[model samples]
Target: MKLFVYGTLLRGESNHHVLEGATLLFEGIKIQAKMYDTNIGYPAIELEEGSTIVGEVYEIQEYIWSSLDALEGYTGNPLTDMYSKEIVKVETNEGLIEVIVYTICDVSMKSVLIPSGNWIEYRSSLIR
Candidate 1:
């Protein structure tokens, strides 16, 4: 299964260990979504129109789904989940493919908008 990761799960990020056995199929892929700084440690995204979000695509093992879901606070219940799993179209080198993405369920957590849409770039800028 293919997963679209935009925040901590991306390469060199804090929670990347969860994808240890996964293969990176694509990087810097842009999809229509609005990314925001949660004001905690990581970032969150909302599926929105007229916005682009930069993230990576990974081919993961079936067993990894459970771990990923848990880490993202997904319980298969939209009302209770912090993030809800959704299938969205992403443009890759090959073509547009549908991949699983976890979008923020609560908009209240979103504090700042990430204009660049690239979390890594936005994060690095904060350091320097």
Candidate 2:
């Protein structure tokens, strides 16, 4: 199973710790989706075409979904409520493939700057 993480799960981010034992494919790549800086807590993701944002891709065991889902607060609750976890097409140095994506939900704004789309770098910029 392949997973695409665009936010906190990106390498060097706080949440990447959850994927400690998984196989990492790459730590660079941008995905197209509407990104929002939700005033409530974290961020938000929407289905938007041609919207470029950076992230990472990984190949993991299918069984790892449950654990990953729990880390992302999925399964029991609702991914859409916290973050919309969807399968989207992403390009890695290898090629195009379907990978699981955890996108933000609810908030929408045209002015939110996604800052490189690389969550780690984006977070770094937020601090500076």
Candidate 3:
């Protein structure tokens, strides 16, 4: 299964170890969605038309899905989860591909919009 990661799960970020053993399908991919900075110091992606979220896509082993789900706090119950995984089309250099993405299922409106759409850069600014 392929997964698109836009925040901490990306390479070199804190928490990136969760994706260990996964094959990196594409390091540069973008999806049409609104990116925001949550109060908890992490970035979240929300479904939005005509907006872009930059990230990477990985083809993970089937067994890794459970760990990934747990890491994202997804329990298959959308109503109470911090985030929910959904399949979305991501634009890559090869073309568009459907990949699972962990989106912010709640507190979306409360987050500050990340106009730059680059979480790594945004996160770097916060640290310095």
Q: Scored by CA lDDT, what does every candidate get?
A: 0.93, 0.66, 0.86
lDDT of model number 2: 0.66
lDDT of model 2, residue 119: 47
lDDT by residue (1-128, candidate 2, tens digit) is: 77877766666666677777778887667677756655443445665777766667888776777777776556544535555578888787778888878765434422365644544555567789
Q: Superposing every Cα of model 3 onto the true structure, what RMSD results?
A: 1.5
Best by TM-score: 1
Count backbone overlaps in model 2. Answer: 8
Error of 3 at 85 (Å): 1.3
| Candidate 2 displacement at residue 68 in angstroms | 2.1
Worst 10 residues of 1 by lDDT: 73-82
TM-score of each: 0.96, 0.76, 0.92
Q: Return the lDDT, model 1, position 50.
A: 98
The per-candidate count of clashes, in order, stands at 0, 8, 0
How would you encode candidate 1's per-residue C-alpha lDDT over 19-99 as one tens digit per residue? 989999999898899999998988999998899999999999998999999999999888888899899988888999999
**Candidate 2 clashes between residue pairs 3 or more apart in a chain or in different chains:** 29-55, 30-53, 30-54, 31-53, 32-51, 44-104, 45-104, 54-117
User: Could you tell me how far off, in angstroms, the CA of residue 48 lies in candidate 1 after the best superposition?
Assistant: 1.2
- What are the candidates' C-alpha RMSDs? 0.8, 3.2, 1.5
